[model samples]
Target: MKFATTVLLTSAIWTTSALAAPRAGFGVPPKAPGDKNGALAAEQSTSADIEYGYNWAGVIHTTPPATGTYTAASATFTVPEPTATDDSSGGKQGASAWVGIDGGTYRNAILQAGVDFYVEGGTKNYDAWYEWYPAYSNDFNLSISAGDIVIVKVVSSSPSQGVAILENESSGQSATQTLSADPSTATLGGQNVEWMVEDYQSGSSDVALVNFNKVKFTGVQAETSDGQKIGTDGATIYDIQQNGDVLTNVTIISDTEFDVSYEAAQ
Candidate 1:
């Protein structure tokens, strides 16, 4: 499998440099709690609304039909084992699955959390993490493996303060951490919510994407400040693209669920 190095910037307000690297202090991995069942179960939904864009393949809900002080967003999906490719530049190859609030309208900040799957020199690495943009992401100590059912979530009390949670249902391991938005940047709009499978990129270098085949996000739901549970009624879907061509196919399974299939377009 081959992966493209250049990606189209989907957001006009945010530049590639700003979203490229994980900042130094943004993502603080949570301490692993003892293996336990009965973690907070995410709400399950059977329907979802779908729309489509570039560089991102998933669902995005903005304010209009679903508007308010968006407090939290969550999604559950299995970690995919991407097919590794040799990078002529000797870089890693992989992708990330995450759910984040804000970054659609307001460009400067996003409160997000997820897991990463990448290959380096023939070895595949899986790590769970959380990040508040402009700072580097922090990794959790919990063991991660392909096919593990992972549920990730981000919740904000306000625009600047939030907590990220990750749970591996298959392993019974979990991590949680508190974070503040970048102090130097503007506050998060708390307007847009997203569940995405991203081609992991770091510090201006494109990590060779792994062919994860197909990843499906289920049990999707978000909450507004006023306490309204919003579904994917009018959410917009985006496709990750290299140049002007699409690389992934996003299909809405229901009003609150969707699937992303990788095309391995390089």
Candidate 2:
């Protein structure tokens, strides 16, 4: 029933075709036509090393506005490990989930924490298959060349933090790399880029923007130990937008506690 309640739904009208190249493309390509019922019927392995993608066309201000490709937008859902269940009933108690952006290298692509996206089931045992939207929103307009790959990673806050990757549209030239710790330095497309982090504990969920095009790439850095850091090494940050103006360290209390705001960098 949850999947049925998706805020965003994708509809496909293509003639049935065999599972084409598993390369990343628009929304997890439909399972192979024959995969409807078979041994791989419930193949829920999130580590299939498959491709991910999306299509774009929405209300905006730009005239003849730019149209995003299958790679323009993406998100990663990391389902933290679940606690041991009451074997007697074989049902888990609870789980924690985190999300990250994926598209290009940490440098080439802009990634921000506290963003909202779908959490697809991947390599995790679930009582039911469903998707949840993040209370926050972060957007980025990447300037990738013809062939580029964007990777989205998600982290869980409970049990044990988990990570999954989303491979977005690529020109067969883009690449992605993950780092366990903040990197000493980073350069976007070989050009040094600056990174900054801002923290606010006012329960405000407004997105903080870090313009990628105007990076300086040389500074000490800042963060809030007791709070969330919007930008980390390899991760690009941005300003939060409200009514077309920029706000700082605020949450979108319009509905959820974690609902933040954001937009693609110009």
Candidate 3:
């Protein structure tokens, strides 16, 4: 997937994030932060629920032992070494870390993979991606740095078909992306199950945002459909608040483990 013919509609109503419109990372979930144009109503209320979006921030589960749906998902992050954030006037700044399956509440499609960090002026880069969210973002010659140790996963066999995997494990290197047909016809409705730390998009808006200062996710599992294998206590917490500050601060550390840090915004 890589055809930026210009498409912009990253909607993350945070039913745990993304709210469909995919990108779960890339142009990165939009439409929640403050209701850019106004149109979001997911929230079911389990307790957590601290909204704000523009490019996701962390954690977001599905159901509540309320049956099954998700195909599969996994996480194990640690590759933050991005600097330059005063909004990074130096041109570009992005940070991505993913583990997705369905763009949360079936916003069309999304089966992800992760690892991406960039700093323009000072020059810094890294890659290892995979996607199927409204398209765009496909690179995995595999070669990463800066704390490495990643382990992203995604799986789906129906709703269009999918399979994305990325593992850096500090360097052991691993990358796989299989698809039978899941491009523009994207459609994965396993609902939401995400663990992101993203601030992506370089063409239609949202770039400048480095200071990765934080990013953590430990084997946060997910594999439902009936087989059952979920974790994420009572998910629902997304940080990242653009102009209003409130960079991020999500901490769960239970049903699997979670922690997303990086303040500075105010």
Model 1: which ten-residue window has the lowest total lDDT? 32-41
Per-residue lDDT over 19-77 for candidate 3, one digit per residue giving the tens place of the 0 to 100 score: 11233332334334234524332344355766656557787774435676888889888
Candidate 2: 10-residue stretch with minimal lDDT = 55-64
| All candidates: TM-score | 0.80, 0.18, 0.33
Candidate achieving the largest TM-score: 1
- Could you give me the TM-score of model 2 versus the true structure? 0.18
State the lDDT of candidate 1 residue by residue for 51-137, as single tens digits. 233346687775633446778999899998867654335557777778988765554677888877877777888878777775556
Preferred candidate (TM-score higher): 1 or 2: 1
> Whose lDDT is greatest here?
3
Model 2, residue 95: distance off in Å is 33
Supply every candidate's count of residue pairs whose N, Cα or C atoms clash at under 3 angstroms.
17, 26, 5
**RMSD versus native structure for model 3:** 16.5
Question: lDDT (CA) for every model shown?
Answer: 0.67, 0.21, 0.68
Report the C-alpha lDDT of model 2 over 1-266, residue by residue, as the tens digit: 11111001112111111110111111223343223222111112222111111111111111111232111112222222222322213321221122223212221222222111222222223211111111112122233321222334333222112222333344222223232211212211211111111211111121122211111111112222223232222222232222333322212111111112222423
Ranking of models by TM-score: 1, 3, 2
